[model samples]
Target: MLFNSAESQTVNIYLDDSSTPAYSVAGCGRQNDNRGTVVLTSGKTGTVLVGVCSGENACALMSQAIDISPPSDNSCVGVVASSTAGGDTNSAYVILTWKATS
Candidate 1:
C-alpha cells in the first residue's frame, strides 16, 4: 500500500479482523521508501488490512483488505540445516526441517 503523505509517517498492517495492528513501520514517506510488505502465515483463511497515517493523528489516509487462503498441500516450504561428516561444514545434503501438517 502507498503512503500518500510527503512527510514521514507510520504505516500499520493488520491481519484478520483485529483492531490492533500486527505490524507497524515508522518514518515512512511517499517517496520510494513508502512501500512495505508483510508475510501472512496463520495457516487459516483471513484478510490483510493496511492503514497509513501521519503525525499525532490516528486517522487512516487509506485502507484496504487483501484476502488470503491457506497454502496448498503440494507446496514445499521449510527450513534446511546441513553439515558434513566430522562436523565439517564444507558440504552436506539439504534437509527440509518443516513437516507437512496434512
Candidate 2:
C-alpha cells in the first residue's frame, strides 16, 4: 500500500507479521516523525521494504535501511522519522508488500 497526501499531517499503518511475510517496499512515505517498519518472523522467515517520502515542512525524504537477520521467528521493528534541516511542509508517502515465507 502506497500512502501519500497531506504534507503537514501524519498517519500510521499497523502491521501483523506473526506468520512471517516476505516483502518489497516502495511508495508509502513519511513526515514530521520517523516511520516504523516492523518485521515479525515467528514460524517462518521474511523481510520488510520501507520507502519514506519527503514531507512539506521537512526538507527531504526519509531513506533508511531496515533489515532482519538470523531469520527471526518472532520480533518487531519501528523506524523513526528522519529529522530534516528545513521546516517546509511538502508531504510524501510509502509502500509495503508482505508475503508468507514459510
Candidate 3:
C-alpha cells in the first residue's frame, strides 16, 4: 500500500487467501462490504487499496485491487456482483475506498 512517485514505483499488499478482508466501521468512512471496484479521478494517480466490510463489524473490510494506471480510465472491475450467494447477479451497497497518492 505504498507508492513512491520519485521512482514511479507502486506496491499493493494483499493478505490471506485472496478473500477480501472485512473491516469494521466504528466512526466514519468505514469500508463497504458487498462487492465492487473503485476508479480514481481528480488528476490523482497511485495505488488504490480496495477494502470490503461486513454489516456487523466496524473498520473491518476485505480489500484488494490491481496496480493500474489507465490512460483514459480503464481496467475496471466488480461493475457486477452476484445478487445471490455465488456471484450470480449485481450486488449493491458494495462500496470501495481509494487513495491516489501522487
Candidate 4:
C-alpha cells in the first residue's frame, strides 16, 4: 500500500497480532511517497492484521485484514457447494449441438 500526506509524518507497519511495530519509517507523502509490503512464509494461512499511522500527532489512518490461503496445484477446478443445475437426478449429461451455416 502507498501513503501520502500534505504535512510531514511518521509511518509505521506492524506484523501479525503484535502491538509493537515491526517497521517504523520516517517522512510523509508531501516530501516523498511511502510504500509498505510484507511477505508470508510457507504453510501460513488465516486472517492477519495490518495498520497504518500518519502525521506527527500519531493518529491511526487505516487498518486492514490480510487473508492467506494455501497454494493450489491447478489439477482441477473447485465447485461451490450451494449451486444446483435445474433439478437433481441420479445421472446427468452434457450435450452439444452444432449446425453449419451456408
Best candidate, TM-score: 1
lDDT, residue 47, candidate 1: 56
Q: For model 3, what is the alpha-carbon lDDT of residue 22?
A: 29
lDDT of 3 by residue, 1-102 (tens): 211111111112223333332232211122223223333332222333444222322222333444456543434333111122223221223333444333
lDDT of 1 at 66: 25
Global lDDT scores for all candidate models: 0.41, 0.37, 0.28, 0.32
Worst 10 residues of 2 by lDDT: 18-27
Q: After superposition, how far is residue 78 of candidate 3 from its true place, in Å?
A: 1.7
lDDT of 4 by residue, 12-37 (tens): 44545657665555543432242444
Clashes of each: 0, 24, 23, 0
Residue 82 CA displacement from its true place in model 1, Å: 47
lDDT of each residue in 1-102, candidate 2, tens digit only: 333333333333323443322443333334323344544332322333333434333323454434556655433344433334345334434433344235
Taking all chains together, the TM-score of candidate 4 against the true structure is 0.36
Model 1 misplacement above 4 A: 1-6, 34-36, 42-45, 58-102
Better by TM-score, candidate 3 or 2:
2
Query: What is the C-alpha local distance difference test score of candidate 1?
Result: 0.41
The better-scoring model by lDDT among 3 and 4 is 4
